[model samples]
Target chain A: MARVNNWQLGREMSYWYPEERPNKQFAAVFDINKCIACQTCTLACKTTWTSGKGQEYMLWNNVETKPYGFYPLSWDLKLLEMLDGQEWSEDGGRYEGRTIFESAPAGERVLGWRPEDEDYSYPNVGEDDCAGQVDGGASIQMPHMAWFYYLARICNHCTYPACLSACPRGSIYKRPEDGIVLVDQGRCRGYQECVRGCPYKKVFYNAMTGTSEKCIGCFPKIEQGLQPQCFVNCIGKIRLAGWISKPGEERPDNPIDYLVRIKKIALPLFPQFGLEPNVYYIPPIHVPTSFTRQMFGPGVDAAIEAYKAAGAEGDDDLTGLLGLFGSTEEVLARWKRSGDTITGYNDKGEEAVSVPLREPVSIRPSYDKLYQITRVNCP
Target chain B: MKKTIPKIVLLAFAILVAYASCGGRTVSLSEVVVVPDQQITLDPTDGAWYAHPYHPAKLILQDMVEPRLLEPSTVEVEVTAMTDGKQIAFRLEWVDDSQNDLPGPQAFIDGCAIQLPTEESVSIPAPQMGEEHKAVDIAFWRADWQAIVDGRADEITSIYPNATVDHYPFDAESLKKDPDAKRRMEQRYAPARRLGNNRSGPRKVPVEDLRAEGPGTLSPAKTVSTGKGVRTEKGWSVVISRPVPGFLSKEKSSNIAFAIWQGANRETGARKMRTGWIPLVIRGAENE
Candidate 1:
């Protein structure tokens, strides 16, 4: 077994400090093997959150088909160009990865140095821009190798979010209580600093209000001990919301522990980019390792292997917890052992767990009931 | 061999350079024509209105007046003659109300010469003849004035300032007497008419009954407490025992005025205006 490095552990713990920071630190672990890409979660979030003017161009949560897939037309490529240095040729042509800044004449300078420079780089390819259907090659001879998968993504609410550091107006802030990063609309001048600063480009400018807005992480509902609208409405049952252990705190031996820790299927998205995104994903099962390494990072193989080993150990609790949408023996035992106190170490010192602090409670009924209460006008 | 090669290359280069320089062509600059600014003047025959294009002025009208006469009264027509051999024509029409065309006795004056060279004055007498008044609508147009009337050339805005219509009351009786006479006169004098208003007084009409009773009741009278502690025979009570003017009542104008004016008037020899001309008469003898 490869030794787990301190950088990865330290990076993970930074998210959990100052209160097991809620949605910002707590990531949603997606079992991509089970995700049918029905787009239920995407639609659910769209109707609840992004159904406002100026939000028309935004998809706070989106399930994009992979390979040739991107929401704002090559958003990843445009961002990569900004992040990686590019240089101008002697003949005044530009090529990527050549120089930090392009050489120009005294009066002329190449534009678009920062991420915000490519604000609309994500091309929202409308239906009009779609290529018409066409057949390629002989049907039998044409390779069936092109496989597309769905990736549901949102603000990772990162540990050291680039957006927070980039804001000059000091409008974007992470709550000390829950670590939820929020844009103060009153203070924001719409300089689009946060939008450019955020490597993920999650902060979107609302043209109607003339201010910046982002995911609020459903803080009001979370305060009532309820999951976020996105997680609660996830039809695939692929999203789980719970507090992570505080730094130095031993993780619980429950199903959440198995799903998040032991199985190791839940890996952080684009860890190589070093954002330490809170949202994690169970790597898509059959994609080639080379593609995964390029997309995710070098640790993809080991993470998958650890998950497989955990399953083979005849740990039904581990297996069941790792399975799709069913409570495993471990989950049941944890539920039965409720109120049984156990001592655990937090960052400061050891503390007794009077009850399972963070467990996956039934989010559907509460969400439906809350919907009914808040949506009194609904038929 | 090398020396010969260099000579051959130089000879080819010289031939290419000679062909390239000789192939270049020249372009001559076109003649620039500077057109002098045209001066347009609409001087009303009655001298009631004057409009000069060189010094444009605006007339403001309010909606309270009659809508027919509220329109623009007059516009002058002028254009600089261009030597491009192109004839110029000018036409003015009311933008809003197309049915009201400007009456005309349009004139083509030499703009270079401020005075009308041929005629001292061109009169477009009000549309109505002498007595029974009818409303007159008038505007001006100039073209190769001959071609415009002949319909040979289209009316162009560049040659004409914006079209304006002036409505004025005309004598209806005169129009009736010369039914065919009016048409003949219009045709005869149509070229010299200029459209504009002659009136210079305020045009707003005052509105009566500006305040109308709406759905709700009027505000109720406030019950003000006096400080004298007096209970009237009527159920209304006053608690004046505290102070003459309570804190809440200090802001009232009547209370503040009474306090200031209640003192004796030294200028009037202590004679109180409120006590009337004399003191109350007694029931005893008048002179005792």
Candidate 2:
């Protein structure tokens, strides 16, 4: 074991491999407050990469309602039970608990479990299921009748991937150029240790191929300077694909670094697990702290407060960056706010997306001069 | 006698490891005799196997030293080998409560393998997958592979009987209706087969020839071996047939090893029950 720094944990933790970060890391952010759970991203990913045999059940990207939903039944609840007393030293500071690697069984690399075939049968078992209770005829207010939020998920492409460490054959690899984790089809003997080791249950076994496979992070598109299919086709505009930097190496102009580091409006999901997950989520503002804190770590209440200030409290930089989500097909590398408009640039310093802090509304004239047609319903 | 294997999975390495002497454990010679029986057949259920006496080879944890082992489901295997001077065949039997023939992500396959030194020498390499430059040739027999070769498991439907499927676009209806659809589907979906991952490929023979230099260096050899497995009332009885090892080809007396993995216990590579080099002496004509 090697002692490596996990910025999310605010301390060094035990990891199988020595700390060797890539030059650039693939990352994304999901706005839970904006997601409507249409599953367009899921189907887009399915048709693009996983339409082949043995891939019928794989959804590289999925949206599940939090507190009662999981792709493979209780993927989180089981590990949470195993970890037991998970707590943080402060509200948004150091995590004072065991990570999956620290709490792993003796001789095991990670704290994980393999799901049965039946567990993956229901991809959306608890779709839109409510959690908290409410009395009859509850008023429509901030604390809603029942709390539920859409959580979009994908491979975190962790800095210290559990799947990579569990393979006895060393078949799984994390690409140093893009930090994308992949399975070497040739070297893998189909032991399925990667399947049993990933805490998020993202890696899947292809029974037909008899090898494990996982999200490629769409490196092909990334290399071509375009966003992933799911990120580009998200109809809800609740997702953004970009590069993330370390805590001290925070780039204020990078959209991901700006939201995750500068403004701290977006926090990693289950940071206590300590994989240094790249994908960040903006917790829903209305959810109870008791539930959200454990899911997103001690940063939940603070992140939600900062997220609220993005729009209602007039934080222009944050309000501008949130508007850049799903704004273009190009992967955003650098972003900046100019007065009322937010402009995002690609890696090559070319302008990609420019959006206003608030959308503009226009009403047509009651009568047209050229066509001579009168509007039926005029305000 | 009611056989009850102690649930304590603490495998004492000094007793069973080939290099235990290097670790300050005194070595005691354990031998299993291999006689020259002309009527040896590669049929595990041959009733002829009852004629020869079974040699008990107690198993130890493979690769990992003690305190590192979680549990080993298989404790021992009964071995009996016969040779016609040209080829060698050995029958391995063990007791298992569950017969695991399908190797899915959640399920593993029951298997047994016999390993032999590639060269003839008095000193043998480390028994835990051998050391670098000291290659050990191995022949492995898997229940799942045997099931496929026996026409028991044919395709995806065979592994997962109740798996509901709408359709796979690559698996065109025209192709499924073809006479050799199984071969074609095996070619398409099973990428391992296409890339020549002999471990996961469609099995023409029940056993594959493999060579290993170290723990993670197991690869397919250039030769072919044959085997058969039959799930009995107690467990599995498997017969593996292959050319005599170079060490055994030159000398009548040589050393060999045995390893078995219990799928139900989630055992596989580097996590198996194995034995150290057990001395084998072929019986002479005078003795026969």
Candidate 3:
């Protein structure tokens, strides 16, 4: 094992291979507060990529009602239990406890579990159940009927992917150009070790073809200077796709860096896993910090507070940049907020999208002289 | 070097057993020699099996080695050999409480493999799958692969029994109008098979010819082997047939090894019980 620096954990951790980072890492930021569990992204991914024989159960993108929902049964709960109470540095920047790689059992590469067939049976396992305040069985009052927030998930394309390291034949690899993790179909032998090693459980086994496949991060689209299908088809306009830089190399013009590094309003899911996941989420403000802190790590309080401030008209730059989420099909390589307009640029530094921060509201008079009729409700 | 002494003593004893067996005398060689016959058969139920002896090869746990299993499940594998003048076949049987012929992410299939050095030399490579510059030929058989070759559909419905599917694009009725689209969908769905990964499914045979110069170097070989496995009351009995090994020389003496995986015990790649180099005494028409 070699010591590789995991900026997420703020420490060097042991990994099977030495440190070799990609040139440009694919990253995304999901605004949980804006998601409405529409599942448009899920269907978009299914039809575009996973509409296959053995991939019938694959949901490369899924929006689960968090606090109770999980894609593969209790994926997080089981791994968290295995870690046995993770303890980070007092400031939450440095991880004090063992990571999945550190706590691996003897003769194993990574500490992981393979979900049973039944686990993938339910893509949205706990969606129907009342999540937030159903404990006391309160009356049907309109207090907070929407207790849970939707967490839209896809492959994070981590820097130190466990799947890449767990594969005995070295079939899984990380792209040197864009940092996209992929399973080489020519080399994979259906060992399912990659399936067990992925913390997010993104890798799936295909019974028909007898090899493992995973979310390619929509590389075909990524190669053509377009955003992924899931990111482009988000109905809630909650996802932004872009390239993230290494620590100490953050650029202000980059939308992903602006949200994840500059504003510190976006945090990775389970940073303690030591994968250095590229996908980031702006924590939900309504959810308890106690719960969000454990899921998103110590950055929950800061992220939630910053996100709440953006909505309260305190952070215009942050709010305006979010308006560029679903504004274009092209990946937002660079972004800028000038006056009332938010402009996003494509990889070639060409303008791809420009949207106003606040859309104009229109009203009609109660009486329509031209039509010789009076409106019923409008005034 | 002290460990070589036991191997040398075993080699000497194996030579004595071969001489005794060749003399047409009834001798119970200690799992060391197999007298050949022209009418060798692969069927475990065949009377020809009784003509040969099932030598008990004790299995050792693959533990403490880098990329090794934590525990062993199979204790021993009963082995016997035969030849049909052109090719050789080895029959292996082991006791497993359950028959695990299904393949899933969590499922492992009952399987066995035989390894023979590609070259007959004074110094043998490491028994734990040869070393660099020293290669071994492997004949691997999987019960699931056998079931597939025997007409078991390699589909999800065959394993789950109650599994349901709305529709696969490649199998959709609408795509029949567009053969190009249908072919594209089929090709897209089975990428591994399209790329010619033999270990991945849609196979025509149960046994695979594999070669490795060291651990993790295993890959498909040009030779095509064949095998069949039957579920017995106790466990499984399998026969793996391959070409006459090129290493068979006039010396009439060589080494062989065996490995077994119990699917029910979650035994698969690298997680198996194997034997060290066992003395194999052979006397074929070509060698003689």
Candidate 4:
């Protein structure tokens, strides 16, 4: 395992590249409460990237309904089942379980997993389905225990990406500039280690070229100061994309940095994996608190509380940060509220986007009895 | 004595017929396929392999749990190995129904590989591309690369004529000035063609040397090798040759393994036919 010091996981874990952090890490905050499972972001990412042959079932950005749905059909469930049980030690501030690296038996480079091609053939087999009781009676009481919420997923671009670590040929790498993990096609021999090592199963195999491919974090678009297609095309306005500074680096004006670090409303998914996934999420508040804590980490309560406070107190900075979602095509380095408008600026302090905190609205024309177009008042 | 001699002759004839029926499938033994001490071309039909014995190694379906491929090899590979003291070569002939030399967007290329452990002391590496702590050097020859060497590069139009493009950005004259303009254009517009270009070596030499420490660890080695393949009416005849320092002593033998990837059946990775370790022997001058 990679040598480590000063990590959230106190123990010396698996071997990973020594961290010489990128100037800015690609990060995202997806509000699970706001996601509607519309799959608009999925299609947007598909049309932009993974729409080629051998990529028919790959969803770079997929919103799977939690507690029931999974893109690779129980990707998380299988990992969790394999790990058996996990415990969080508050005093040590670390997880007590076998990480993917620690779990791999001898003679195997990875934790020995190979999903059948059929497993990938169905990315949304159980979409929108929830695990619960099904009663035949007229009086139904299925709501007491059953619950489902949308979990929008993309490449985490982790600080210690298992995919990058597990690639024997060193084909997968995290960019020193933006921290976006990528598979160098020229180097990849389609060993499928990235596909196996990724606990999230985001890295996929391309049988056609006999290599592995994953999200590039839209680095080309990002270089142009543009938000990724998924973030920009989000119909639910749930995704916020920005650079997150490493721990101890303070940039409160950075929307993602503030939400993820300062206010602490956004928490990383599966912190127990010990990869320090860059993508953060405001855990779904409606789900069972225990389930959310298990999935998100011990910070679930604080995150939910901070999120509620931001909306209740109408904190302009927090509201302005939330308003930045899907508001522009350009990447925003910093954001602040100015009266009714939330203005976003690039790293150079040039205004990139400005959106009204609340969109201006006018009365709609009255509809006719025929449910057809009818102008009643005025344009 | 005359009656006994006739019976002996009949018995010998029956045994020969049985061995011929099995198509020269050699038994698992310390088989030594001799290599002459003369320079020889890599042409499979160059009459050079005639001096060596054809030991057909039985290949079975790789029914590993990872891929779970159930299809069996339709024909046994008639193998003849030889070396010219400086370089070792192997000739493999298999009966393939179709010439699946082109790997398109959703296709796999028919190919074969010969695996030998880098260090003789490391015990024969795993049949499935070696294992951790046991490394093997592989010489892989793809049918697609052979087609390119044969001056017949497969195009998208060859597979599907109906699929046509109206216009491409590379058609603009400004981008054509770069030395690698055509290559850059193909890489962006045609992914399948890009893969073929990336995988294949330069024009005359098609085979490349690869090393694997374990499954999913196959990587290109710094040194490349040479291989050639010819498609006949019923099958393919492939010859893979690599330069070796010298032949091993009779006391020391190298373990050899083979894997075949059939393009028509979507066979790749762990999904291919393979043979177990065959103690490869290079005949010494005293034995010859």
Best by TM-score: 3
Clashing pairs in 3: none
Candidate 4 C-alpha lDDT tens digits along B97-196 = 8777654423567888888787642576777778887888889888877866777534434444454644345556777777488557545533433655
Each model's TM-score? 0.41, 0.88, 0.91, 0.70
Compared with the true structure, all predictions reach lDDT values of 0.36, 0.81, 0.82, 0.73
Among these predicted structures, which one has the highest DockQ?
Answer: 3
Model 4 clash pairs are A1-A14, A1-A15, A2-A14, A2-A15, A2-A16, A191-B216
Model 2 lDDT tens row, A188-276: 87788888888888998876666888888988899988988999999989989899986589889999998898878788888999899
The positional error of residue B199 in candidate 2, measured at the CA in angstroms, is 2.8
lDDT of 3 by residue, B132-241 (tens): 88888888998888888889986778988888888777888989899989877887877887788887766788888888777767888875678788988879899887
* DockQ scores of all models, one per candidate: 0.01, 0.36, 0.58, 0.11
- Residue ranges of candidate 4 with Cα displaced over 4 Å: A5-12, A90-92, A132-146, A338-341, A356-379, B1-33, B37-80, B83-88, B91-138, B142-186, B189-239, B242-288
In model 3, where do residues sit more than 4 Å from their true spots?
A134-146, A363-379, B1-34, B64-67, B119-123, B174-181, B284-288
Displacement of the residue A94 alpha carbon in candidate 2, Å: 0.7
The order of the candidates by DockQ, greatest first, is: 3, 2, 4, 1
TM-score of chain B in each prediction: 0.14, 0.80, 0.84, 0.79
- In terms of docking quality, how is candidate 4 classified? incorrect
lDDT score at residue A266, model 1, on the 0-100 scale = 73
| Model 4 global lDDT (CA atoms, 0 to 1) | 0.73
Cα lDDT tens digits for candidate 3, A209-291: 77889989999999999999998888788899999998889999999999999998999999988899999999887776777
Q: How high a TM-score does candidate 4 get? A: 0.70
Better of 3 and 4 by DockQ: 3
Which structure is stronger by TM-score: 3 or 4?
3
